[model samples]
Target: MDDELHRRLRIEQARALLDNADPRQAVMLACDLLMAGVNGDAVVALAAESARTLPAYDANRRLAAVIDELGLPELDLPTAVALIAADTCERILDCSIPAEVGTHRLYVVGYEGSPLDHLLPEVTALAAHLEDDLGGRADDDLRTRLGALARTILDRLKAENPA
Candidate 1:
């Protein structure tokens, strides 16, 4: 599909989420709309035209700061997955790499489910944890390898420590 159609579909999806999702989910969707330059003001303007209070406005406002600080990529699918996994690993493993590099191999691994399924809570949590990697994106082959590696590592750790 074309860029305009894709963008419009995203907007429609966000709108549906705003109407039906819980606060946390709605906030994330709202942030996405804002980032896409989807006329957030117009979206919420009818309620209070002058104030321009978009749905989940407070959360989106906070997210704006996060985006400004971390910087989102033009194509964030693979980047988001790698970064999230890396960041999560960094936290869970007491990993030696910089806070930006989860478990060190996280950039070339798996964490995110799929871009097509990004609206899921798990995906969002992964992205947020990535607040800290992404020297590369996580493609399917890489994700598969990473998944097996992660399982092996987890099994070894469990066996060694019994925790």
Candidate 2:
């Protein structure tokens, strides 16, 4: 499929999922990806639009927290994602996740031996989210901006060993 067409398709799928207020993991994942900077304002808007329609229950309390966090004006999604990537990388150096899980996640993205490969999942999720929601409407620089974020996160690593 054409890149643009694929992007549009994902956005539509995500939007429909958001608009319907379904109680499911797909909706939750979409919202989380959006929070992580998938489609930016479109994800934000669609999430907010469907908030009240979301089924009210104890299970939804977690969703409520995510939705509430998204509403905060102080959080910049791209920067936040970069910060998360950097923090997760640090955690690996610090032995946060069990070694097996960490390696699998990192190896999936960092096959080129790039240190910042762990950011791939979040970035991939962002791209997936971007594919559907505002992705179709994204400016030419969206990819560039996202790439810069990954670079920015990597820069913060500042290897003390100096290779």
Each prediction's TM-score against the native? Answer: 0.24, 0.27
Which candidate ranks first by TM-score, i.e. highest? 2
Each candidate's clash count: 1, 3
Identify the candidate with maximal lDDT.
Answer: 2
Model 1 residue 83 lDDT score: 30
TM-score of structure candidate 2: 0.27
Model 1 residue 155 distance off true place after TM-score fit, in angstroms: 16
lDDT of 2 by residue, 1-163 (tens): 3444333333333223223213443245546666555655544544454443445342244344444544632333333333334544444455565333333333233333444566667656555545565543444354444445445555655552233
